[model samples]
Target: MRPYLFLFLLGIVLFFATCRKKDTTPTPSTPVVPGCTSLLAPANGGFVTTTSVTLSWNAVSTASSYDVYLGTTPSPTTLVGNAVSGTTHTVSIPATPNVTYYWYVVPRNTTGPASGCASGARSFTYIVISMPVSLGYHVVGYFPSYRSLADVPDIKFRMTNVVVYAFYQVNSAGSLLAPGSATAPLAAVATKARSNNAKILLGINDGSGDGKTNFKNMAASPQGRTNFIRDIMNVVRTNQLDGVDMDWEFPTTSDGTDVTFTSLMQELADSLHRDGRYYLSCAITAGKYAGGIRDAIRNELFPIVDFFNIMAYDDFSTTTPYRHHSDYALASLCLNYWINTRGMPAAKAVLGIPAYGRPSGITQSNTVLSYRNILSQGGNAQLDSAIVSAGTFTNYTIYYNGQYTVKRKAKLSKDIAAGVMFWEKWQDATDGQSLLKAACDTVGRSY
Candidate 1:
């Protein structure tokens, strides 16, 4: 009831109100420590193979050990494993194919009874391939002439599982014949092959020779074209051959032949498929020119044939010992380009490896040799590299130092499709060690 007492009460009330305001305002929380020092493996946002992914990370500072966890939801995670005083740790994840998984790491400091939780979680995804396998091979076939037809049964029987065989010819001069009417035996041999439960492909390719021009004529002219198709189909029907393989040396518009060659191939594919029989295949040239043409083929025939065999070996020749056709780099490069960029499916592509080498004096210019012959000339290791069976040619290209080299064409076979097909069977070693065998093993092919 007195002014002094009333004023004193008001002051007390004002002071209490100020204190309440300060207490009501929230205080900032300590910045939560980050999860782990660092992470790896299915690296940050990485794509990985296999259902179990290994999650790893560096241990946090002042931490004596680490613990890892993963889950589909946030926090209160499922622990994967714990490591002691280590900078890094790996945790195996059990996940289904094509599913994304989230994981995190926690650091444990000896000072505390419990380990500290990670600041956040890291995530990864997994992909599962049905079967990841490949095939490889050396020379496919070899026949001096029609006289070699008698050897067809022997060759096919001997190389029971050979998927492809190259046919060769000898001109009137008795020299190795390039593509011509002289190589007609191919059609008959292919027929015999089919009857024997084997597949045969004629060798109609000639690298770095005028034979390319002859090939263009054969593909362009109606008569030559019909003969070519007839020879192949006849072999298919009579010998029961599985397919026809075109081995034109190379097709380039530089000489106005690229378009024609492509047209020929498309026409043949259409014709062959219409019959509802015979597999159509081809050995596309390797390197820039080969690569360019293959890109065109993929656009034209990705859905046409059984597979496209790219001759990846011999980027260079014996003349350039440092560079040659069997160069692994070129082989891998062509494979990646076609499969990854050219829109060709991995299963529909085959990488060609040489069974032989070029003589040393030969230049980067295309030259081929037989693997069997190269083996006798100190190329044993090289030949062995290809993992072949009998009835496959060893195209012998001479290296500069007389140390002949063979291409280990098998490496890619197990990872790619269709398998390796070669140029000639006669050029192969008769000792039962041939490229066909190697390829069969790699791709799990039988017969």
Candidate 2:
């Protein structure tokens, strides 16, 4: 064998070895097109109470990202989110009620997007709340004497049709207790409320102890009822109030107080309605749970009262996934119980929405944080539950209705009830994050 031939063969072997090494390095392969995602939330043809909605879909295996499209038409030409990495996309714009909205999610990989995604688009109807035009919707707020009047925004007074000056206590004998230090504040608030074109009412309730015992005793006898009505009217006249709101915590059927309660309410309504210029309202229980507490508000008193403020908050359920004290579900149930089960008129049903939230793992009465304080302590406005440090506990998960839920509830009120009512006006935030403002905005009421 010649040296030149052997050298040439060795060089060829080296060249072949280099080529093999190069072949060992992996070559890039084209990515497979992702499968179409399945829409999960806001079920097709379903109704959504909230303006802000979260659009969610089942993740596709090969999907690197997703494109979300939403619009009024079936095809949904508007591109809401592009290249969204997650399976969910929260709608940033507020949805209009009574409008049908269509959405499409297109799963995509490096190769291309899934085909026929728009053809399989889903749709949902934003509920249209038909509010009465004749009577006009009422936004009622309870102004408690304990809270500083300055904390309440001036816009709140104007937003509310009725501002209740809470709790001028009543004795067992049906005589009114002195306002004492609250008199000046009451007068000031009443004056402000009246100036804002809001009807201010004097709220009467049983004093400190014995729950509804004082109210029960007062309403039991004719003389006591007469005395109570007289004092209420006198107080209304003195305060220049438009009417009276009876806050009898509860008058149970088991004790026969419910019977007397009807009589008392009838008498009060007669006296207040005589001039045809005053309103008579009552703060009733949520009626979510079964018991004497629910049956307290008898059906007979429906016609006697102008409106019943259904206290729908402070609900506690151990079996629920999240222990939300004032959840939207509870509000719906309360309204159904009042208007459907009990046969109360929809126009007279005023749903109550709390301005405060209760912490998880804590009793409803044990811990309550106002919406403003919750936001100040790192509460998320978008999410319903927030992890925050409250009192001795660190990283406590507090469950409350955020701005979204408040707006949802307000919309719910317009759908089936006269209006929405807050437990206390001062509990709301002063800024744009104000729960009152959210509610008013949803109901199309300017604040």
Candidate 3:
């Protein structure tokens, strides 16, 4: 009985000893891969105007390095960076305009790359930096009273040789109408123009209601013309402006005002030139089809005015297949009509371009949109037309002079015209994609 007891006790002790040895043995653990990182900069679906873009991501604790993929497609296969130790990488993309690019970053460790990182990919649209165009050409920009004065940048003043404030109303009595609430705005712009050494002018157009009729009646009478010249001079003097820009939409032969239009301009020119400091310019029609109205800007008045802002964009030729209100062909024809056909001096012809775009279809709901708005709505800066989707149901195409067209026109103007003029300065994009900038660049003017 005693021997059996000893053997049982030994067996129990050995069983306990074996259990303790097994518990003391160590077991290898599985390694942890890096967690997914968040993307930063050039936010998803954003626009970048520069050639080089910096891509960055949030750092992960376990990440040993990062792998970068970038390409034109959604699932970017091109690996730009392999095992990059940093959290950011700058890649030089193509300088092409309006190109969409996609990119993603994968955090990696010795264990492996972070899973589900492909879903974190992002996209951006690239807009090429606008290049400089030409030198020794004038750039004229019109500023309407309705536009905010704050919209006009200091750089714009530097770009323009002449800036016209449009417009002060003209009453039937031939007296100048004040711009009312626009006084402060005008004063602000004037100060900016003076500081930038730019010539500023006050624009005159017919008043509201029977304004056209009043303008015609006033111009027909000698007394009315005399009053107009005197009142306009007084206003120009009060404003300390460089000169006046006359925007008589059209003086038709049917109304018998076409003849009076020349006489009025001639008289006004005489008064302005007598001062010796003030300059004179007139905004004339494109002369494509407005019969006597088009013919109204005769050769007799060409020598009187300092220059003619050939309103060359509103009317398109009948031969065009597309409804491009202002196209390269129209610009050429208008220049020809003014310089060659009308016998006006090439130096006196300033080609006019629109800073706004019209819809491709004549019946489109939105008649016009500013060039800035066009680009904001996904309009390509390189192309002349954009297919815009306004809402879920509204989709239309807008036609305007993109950077390419603007550069081309500016080059053409340098060849034959004095300079280029846009309708309103505020309508222009205030960036690298600005049509005004594109024109200035193409003409070799520094802004």
Candidates' C-alpha lDDT: 0.54, 0.82, 0.81
Model 3: per-residue lDDT, tens digit, 1-447? 999999999999999987784555668765698888999978999878778899998899999999999999988889999999999999999878778999999999888999887777999988533212222366888988888877767897888988898888777566778676773366677778878877888888888564376678788888988888888988788779888889887787778887898899887776666425677888988877748788777788877888889887865333443688888999999999888987998888899999977765345444467888889988888888876654342556667889999999999999998999999898888888988889888877876
lDDT (10s digit) by residue, model 1, range 1-447: 699999999999999987784546668664334334566666766666665555666645566667777776555378767654564545555656556777777765544423344446667776542211222322244344433555334543334433454544222221234344544355555556556655454444543355466665555555655556555555456655555666666666566567667666766665555424556667775534443444435366666655677776555544443344455556677777777767777766776655565543343244444666556555653322322222333343353111122223455644654455454455555554555555444445554
| Position 284, candidate 3: lDDT | 86
For candidate 2, what is the TM-score?
0.67
**Top-TM-score structure, candidate number:** 2
Model 1 regions more than 4 Å off:
1-188, 202-209, 215-240, 288-298, 317-319, 360-369, 382-408
TM-score for all models, in order of appearance: 0.51, 0.67, 0.66
- lDDT, model 2, position 397: 77
Q: Which stretches of candidate 3 lie over 4 Å from their true place?
A: 1-136, 209-211, 316-321, 389-393
> All predictions: root-mean-square deviation over Cα?
19.2, 26.5, 27.4
Q: Per-residue lDDT of 1-447 in model 2, one digit per residue for the tens?
A: 699999999999999987784446777889899888889988999867678889999999899999999998999889899999998998854555568889989999889999999998999877533222224688988888777877776787888888999778888567988555663378888988988888888888888576688888788899999898998888887877888888888888889998898899887876676536578889999998788877878888887788888999877553454688888999999999899998999999999988777775555453568778889988877668887776666676778878899889899989988999998788777888888888888888875
Please give the lDDT score at residue 362 for candidate 3: 45
The 10-residue segment with the lowest total lDDT in model 1: 399-408
